[model samples]
Target: MAKKPEDKVLAQNKKANHDYFIEETIEAGIVLQGTEIKSIRNAKVQLKDAFIRIRNNEAWISNMHISPYEQGNRFNHDPLRSRKLLLHKKQISTLIGETKRDGYTIVPLKMYLKNGFAKVLIGVGKGKKEYDKRDVLKKKEAKRDMDRAFKERNQ
Candidate 1:
């Protein structure tokens, strides 16, 4: 197998996990202009508060902010405009079918440069309830307490 290119992951939507349960992930190519690609390469992209929606049998990502290139003059793409995601026919069909269910959504989890091109990792997720969030918090706190207790006991 070929090696994956080394890219500095610019941004991630970590809160997506805390707020929703990720069921599946798919990497999709993004349609970007020249300056938008340059801005992403410089780690100036925001994946937070971004989401994907299927419409007219295609998926569109909205609210992802790719900053304008510092040197670009009158050719900069809009920072928060919707961007199209390229996915295979089968994947799009499957996503459309599954997302039709209740509480399922398409969320952009991360953005990274792949083979010198921009790629977005989209996740199929179900939103978590308030009780679920509290449970996760309680589990995290318990794990931390356990780690501290073990260290104290060892010392």
Candidate 2:
């Protein structure tokens, strides 16, 4: 599909990928106010400390910061308030079950807009052990060295 610039990423949680093994990700709608959307469009958002929580059979994003809109008055939404995520009932149930298990969680990977609507990329993730992260780092280093060697050989 063609990429939309307005949907051009507002924030990405790259640390989530490094710290956890993301099994699957789904595009979910976000409930936002007019000012929130405007702030997002301006790229005044932070997702580093953001996370997903399952509550009352639903998912909400917490700790995400969308700066205040320049044109907004008191009606502007709070920057760090919990925002509900729109997901299927089945998805929520599955997440709740998996999260109840050991070392599993729900995390937000990315945030963007889809067709003018705010959307979040939510993932069902399993936390990686220290050894797992080390192994991944080693693999990345090996790949980088291999690529360098291959480039010299080709030249």
Candidate 3:
């Protein structure tokens, strides 16, 4: 058996994990302009403050900032343009239904290249409350402490 090639990650939204409880995740293709793809290939993209929205039965990603390609000049794409997501009709319908519920949202977790095309990992997530964020932080701290103690004992 042969191992599969790993995806080349372009950008990731690290804050998404802290702000949302991801219930499910799905990979979807993105429509990019010429310069946009070039910028992405150079790993000049940002997923912070980016989110997915279902409108008219279609999925769109907004607020994702892809820096303009240095050589693109006047043909550079917009940094914060809304990009269409390619998902099956069934997947779109399911997302629509799930997002109708209170506190549920569609968020972009990461962007990566698969094969030769750009793909985004979107998640169905529920908003985290203040207390929930605090709880997660506390647990992370506890885990870090335990790992440190274990390392010391082993040493």
Clash counts for the predictions, in order: 0, 0, 0
Highest lDDT: give the candidate number.
Answer: 3
Rank all candidate structures by their TM-score, best first, as comma-separated numbers.
3, 1, 2
Decide which is better by lDDT, 1 or 3: 3
Candidate 2 shows a clash count of: 0
Question: How would you encode candidate 1's per-residue C-alpha lDDT over 40-151 as one tens digit per residue?
Answer: 8889999889999898989999999889999998999899999999999899999998899999998988788777778888889999999999999999999999999999
Model 1 lowest lDDT segment of ten: 1-10
The local distance difference test score of each candidate is: 0.88, 0.86, 0.91
Q: In model 1, what lDDT does residue 120 have?
A: 82
Worst lDDT run of 10 residues, candidate 3, spans 1-10
